[model samples]
Target: MDSILFIEIESSYKAIPLLVFKRDHHSSIIKKSHVRIYSDAHALLMAIEEQVQEFQKLIEQQTIQMIEDKERELNEHISHLQASAIHQLTLSQQQWFEKAEEQLNKLLDAQEKRLSEAIADARNSMASAIRNRLIKMNQSDSLIGYLSDALHAELNDVEKSLVIVKSYSDNGTTLTIENDDCMVSINTQELLSELKSCLENISDD
Candidate 1:
């Protein structure tokens, strides 16, 4: 069934005018259509959320790169220092080498601690910032607008014969149809769908 319909086929008639309103077809087409619409909406939202997760992954990759760079630089510095100390020292290997090694170890330990703390602090701050940004995006008015925009695009041109208008207002978010015979009013929030009083005409008499 089309998301919007302007006419219905009656027996062998062509282009029979139809006024489909809500509260009709409760057990059938309307229910399925509502479910389909919501499912599509959820899929789109998840896709957008995946982008956020990808951004977090990028942050993690950059952090790891920074740690690797720092470690490489520190290793090069330590290697240079150890070589210089071993070559320039005047004392015997047993005494002077021992002292040089001890001092170098002390310097390496201090430098490693500093680097670890800096990386830890940076990672925490970056992760916190990402979470905060995502929270803001989820909670802000932007989310509503995004939902409206995405819904509009996702459910585009549902029916060529019917004119559909998506509106967002203080009252509610709705999809309205301009049809001479049938009026489709979809409360995008509640998203209830049905043909109004369609069962009233059913008669056994």
Candidate 2:
């Protein structure tokens, strides 16, 4: 085995090579002194130490750079995730609103249909009641007699003679009075029209 010896120079605070020793097969130690060889060896060791320090610094710089790149990538990914989440939430809210509006429109349409049916039923019931009442009045003999007397009073001044007639049919009643110069007729339809107008006026009041 061969061994290298190092000695420190107090002026430069650097380690310099001093001697090389080796053992022969007989276990005898031999020492060789060569100042130029030892100086070259010391310079080589210093260059190797400098290279190792430079490599360590480079590794530290690369590590820092890698950490920064990873951090930047993570931040970008987080931002993308947040943007996607917001878009999804907005889409969900829009869908909910559309569904709610559709339901509301259907509800309103159903209510409108029901209301229209109710109005139609009420109109039919009222018309039937009016028609039955009018039929009863038409069958009464007292009503015919009263109408005749009223026509006689109205036509006293203008007529040579007046004839009054009462008629009843499925459509309703008709009252007719005729003279030589003029004729007048009244029907249940005309009475119904007058009654509707009066009812509208009363509602407005």
Candidate 3:
């Protein structure tokens, strides 16, 4: 009779698809098989081998289930974080863009206002200059006529025979006159200055 015994068995797996979820392809399996006895063994040894295979299958199934759950949870968490970050970035960019546009519009408005004022000032200054030039031109023509007419009219008027040429200066107008009693001489600038002083004193009063 054989007192010691030896036994051998095989173990493997076959994937089974779970059809519970319509959109997700999740897979799980419940393995079941009759042990094939390769060599005759004692009853005690056969029982131990069966228990070991069952234990191994249960451990493998539990471990794979845990790993799949953890991986799915991790992927979902990462995707959520990425989406949240993108949303926050978009919001921040929109806020900054609005602020920048507002500031730019304000600057443009201020610049336009300054430009308008400057253009108005330039127009006013140009109008003033043109008016002054016209007034000065009229005054100059009148003064020239008066100076020439004074000398010509006085010289042409019939009086006496004697004639006198008066003093001359480069700064102002010169006049010549002849009369019956005495030919008089005068500087018109001094007379005009005295007349202007008298008018100014009257205006002050």
Candidate 4:
């Protein structure tokens, strides 16, 4: 017999499926044996997660490089504009300004799209990992804490530029591990490390 348990996070939360098995049976013995298998699965998941994070970081780095190139082009255009501004403010200067503005806008849009896609990919992977942890711990009473530790380990290996973006209610907070030069006060990486340590301690308890 297959038993399913559905757990909901909240009213807006989707229910997750977990298996149930009766204790003191042969199947229960097999369940205990499966601990080793789950450990193996955990290792495999971590490897896969590392590869995925590497790929994401590569993409992000490439995107940043492309942005830097675009910024150089924009700077050149601005310089040309400034030079033209010194002249009689001709129609040709207006045309150049319009074209430069259009290109800048396009580049900005593309950069934003790339960032959004990368974040979405990370979120999906994280959610899948959480689901797998829950499924593996179906019969265990203390699953959340264990899963939290696993996530912390995973996060430790991720790039400083990428952090998990989660939504509370309808608002979203992007917890970036990278330091932004624009905002010196937000030391997100340190904050995340402390948070992970707390979660791991909870898991140990």
Tell me the whole-model lDDT of each prediction, alpha carbons only. Answer: 0.58, 0.69, 0.59, 0.54
Pick the winner on TM-score between candidates 3 and 4. 3
Worst 10 residues of 4 by lDDT: 167-176
Where model 4 places Cα greater than 4 Å from the true spot, the runs are 1-27, 31-33, 89-205
- Candidate 4: C-alpha lDDT: 0.54
Residues 81-147, candidate 1: write the lDDT tens digits.
9988877664466677899999999999999999988877776666556545544444345545555
Better of 2 and 3 by lDDT: 2
Measured by TM-score, how close is model 1 to the native structure?
0.28
Give all candidate RMSDs, comma-separated: 67.2, 8.1, 17.8, 60.9
| TM-score of each prediction | 0.28, 0.61, 0.43, 0.29
Q: On residues 27-110, what C-alpha lDDT tens digit does candidate 2 reach at each position?
A: 333333444455577799899999999999999999999999999999999999999999999999999999999999999999
Decoy 4 TM-score against native: 0.29
Q: Which candidate has the highest lDDT of all? A: 2
- Better structure of 1 and 2 per TM-score: 2
Kindly list the per-residue Cα lDDT of model 4 for residues 112-142, writing each as its tens digit: 9999888777766665565555445443424
How close to the true structure is residue 191 of candidate 2, measured as C-alpha lDDT? Answer: 62
Q: What 10-residue stretch in candidate 2 is worst by lDDT?
A: 13-22
Ranked by TM-score from best down, the candidates are 2, 3, 4, 1
